[model samples]
Target: MERKQFLRTLGTGAAFALTFPCLQGCSKDSDNGDIEEIPSGVDFTIDLNSSEGAKLADNGSFILKNLIVVVKDLNGNFVAASQVCSHESYDQVRFTTNDGGIFYCDVHGSRFDLDGAPLNQVDSTPAKQLKIFNTELDGQILRVFE
Candidate 1:
């Protein structure tokens, strides 16, 4: 190949390698990485009977602490996970009971199990697991923490 042609090809390849990740919605330090993140060492409670907590009744998805996805399982159990999609950094994940309770990411169609394990990935890359938090129920309140 001619030197000029080779140089052009190399430049294009380098550009794509650097640009592909951002286009794929990957998180960056200045962008989506901290958009959903909350202050660390946080501990809070949600009243199950309150209007704000109504959306989390049963098998419901609730976004708390900006990045946390709090879901109520079929058995009325509370589970907390990062709302950020593993494939990308999309902060829109919903709980679905269609396949025995899974978190579905609208951006990349990625599915995560209740324990934050990846059930599926939208691309050839290895699936990313979600960050999970601990939750406890006390009468009509649910406490969430890291």
Candidate 2:
């Protein structure tokens, strides 16, 4: 083939190669429906002396257990909420010191207050409230329950 014809064929083949994978990735059938659900019947405890419990010793610190995000608020209060984000049901929620200690999902910018209420609109719609579990501290053990 001539140089000009070879160059045209190579460019077209390269363009098709790059675009095909992206187009395939955009198909709805490729979605695995992997959205997570808020945990239920979640009764569990953490020992203050254990390594996992030590994470919550500091104010504004948090730990994830049983699909739950347990946090020590800035005021030193223990609170527990589901790690599942209300928007898109992704398990990416965590407590952050930002906005005075709120649960934030990095996946879609979904924010929830300590009370599990949505803080802002996500995806142009009001996101649902996160599941908030009750927390009780007795001696050196913290109990989290639905």
Candidate 3:
């Protein structure tokens, strides 16, 4: 599947590994989802909050829409992850660091890197990477593809 479509289906830490095609060996930081063709046409960009009328606070969260997306890590390295958890499939949590400092899972004890590599996990739990979508920023508009 393509990146953008993966985002809607997978969660943050469960995307990367589960999505990469022709991957070498599977590990904790990645998933083993099967390879299927991403639909021919799908628009993954959801303006969670438009920057036009909304004010992006210097230290607050302000998005135009609620359709979550995978933005650039604080370091600007690009990686799109599903906001849900592959382990739990819950959509009520997230991992955010304005400074790109850490990936914190609110529901579970999972924490990962900016690249979704695991930093820690619960005992014997199956590790999964978030589903990632490929993206492009057009001026101020982000064009996400699956």
Candidate 4:
């Protein structure tokens, strides 16, 4: 390969390694560096039907077990799945993208639908899914428990 092409490929590989540290390339030469992320659990109940839910109706984010919790839409009837990109894991706090279509990873621009389906880019990056918790509405509150 040409110098520029090789460098570009290297950069892409490096970026992929950084984003998904659990991947293969990142496993090599671990003697030089180690990033140990200790997981801590968190719990939160989102109200998807009331003003409080309305207040947090868009791209609302919470953290649990170092896993990002993102809230997309709650139309008082049902809650929309938070569009979390599995590729880049670019979940923001208290903000939702208006696309209402799919979530995009902030790092490599990988896209996943509301159901967490990968749209395009990269064979190494799997077109898998994200977590979708059960939501409930009782009286005036829609609680996403457990």
Candidate 5:
């Protein structure tokens, strides 16, 4: 085949190869309910003396355990929320220092306050609130519970 004809065929083939996979991925039946559910009945503890717990000593630092994001707020208070984003149910939520201290989902820019209240709208609708768990610090043990 001529060089121009070969190049034209290659471009069309490449476009077709890229298009079908995206079409299949975007189909309605593609989702098989595999998304993780927000953790419930979540009762766990972290020993502040342990290496993992030591991270909370720094304000604005956070740790992920049992699909939960535990954070020490800027005011030096322990707070916990689900790592699952309420917008898309993706496990990409974490504590951020932005706006003082808030839970942010890296998946779709969903933001929530320390109280788990939605701070922004997603897809033109208000995003759902996060599942905020309770935290109690007894000496060195921090208990996180739903």
Candidate 6:
């Protein structure tokens, strides 16, 4: 190959290599049933009178728009939290069937309290607290917001 052509090809390859990683990191965070962006002061309500909404009870939880998980505390109060697992950003958190009032992440065995606080002995390192939202139950309607 000619010296000039080889130098040009090498320069192009180096440029591509340097640009690839930055492009990959620029993608937005994503997951199944996830909301792309949550605006400030978001407030929404779930109708318990509906068929699927009727399934929730005290000490249980329901996933909202697949983004937030709403937990009904043992005292019959409602609480909300981001369903995404902080350690690895998984969205499979659910209430354990026991009386522990905890949300269990199926991905890595992380436990979070109904109030979205990280529980002790989290299996993953650099454990992160779940993002909690304010919740209020008004008759058959449960409102959740950040």
Candidate of highest lDDT: 2
Candidate 1 positional error at 105, Å: 0.3
> What does candidate 1 score on TM?
0.67
The RMSD (Cα, Å) of candidate 5 is: 6.7
- Predictions in order: lDDT: 0.75, 0.89, 0.49, 0.46, 0.88, 0.68
Give per-residue CA lDDT, model 4, range 14-72, as digits (tens).
99878786665556533322222222232355554645555544443322222434444
C-alpha TM-score for every candidate: 0.67, 0.75, 0.50, 0.44, 0.75, 0.63
Poorest lDDT segment (10 consecutive residues) of candidate 1: 29-38
- Per-candidate count of clashing residue pairs (backbone under 3 Å): 0, 0, 25, 3, 0, 0
The residue ranges of model 1 lying beyond 4 angstroms of the native Cα positions read: 1-40, 59-65
Model 1, C-alpha of 62: deviation from truth (Å): 4.4
How are the candidates ranked when ordered by lDDT, highest leading?
A: 2, 5, 1, 6, 3, 4
Task: Give the per-residue lDDT of model 2 (tens digit) for 1-146.
Answer: 69999999999999999988888877744553346878999999999889989989999999999889999999999999998777888788999999999999877688889999998876877679888999999998999998
Query: Candidate 4: what lDDT?
Result: 0.46
Give, for candidate 5, the lowest lDDT window spanning 10 residues: 26-35
Q: In order, what is each prediction's RMSD in angstroms?
A: 11.4, 6.7, 18.4, 13.3, 6.7, 9.9
Q: Give a tens-digit lDDT track for model 5, residues 23-128.
A: 9877734443325799999999999999999988899999999999999999999999988877878888889998999999766678899999998887886678
Residue range 13-129, candidate 3, lDDT tens digits: 476656664254444235422233322343555342565313322222323223233544555544454555455655422446633544545556666565656666655876776
Residue pairs clashing in model 5 are none
lDDT for model 1, please.
0.75
RMSD of 2: 6.7
Task: Kindly report which residue stretches of model 2 are placed more than 4 angstroms away from their true locations once superposed.
Answer: 1-34
TM-score of 4: 0.44
Candidate with more favorable, higher TM-score: 2 or 4: 2
Q: Which model, 5 or 6, shows the larger lDDT?
A: 5
Which parts of model 4 have CA positions greater than 4 angstroms off?
Answer: 1-43, 47-52, 57-85, 88-100
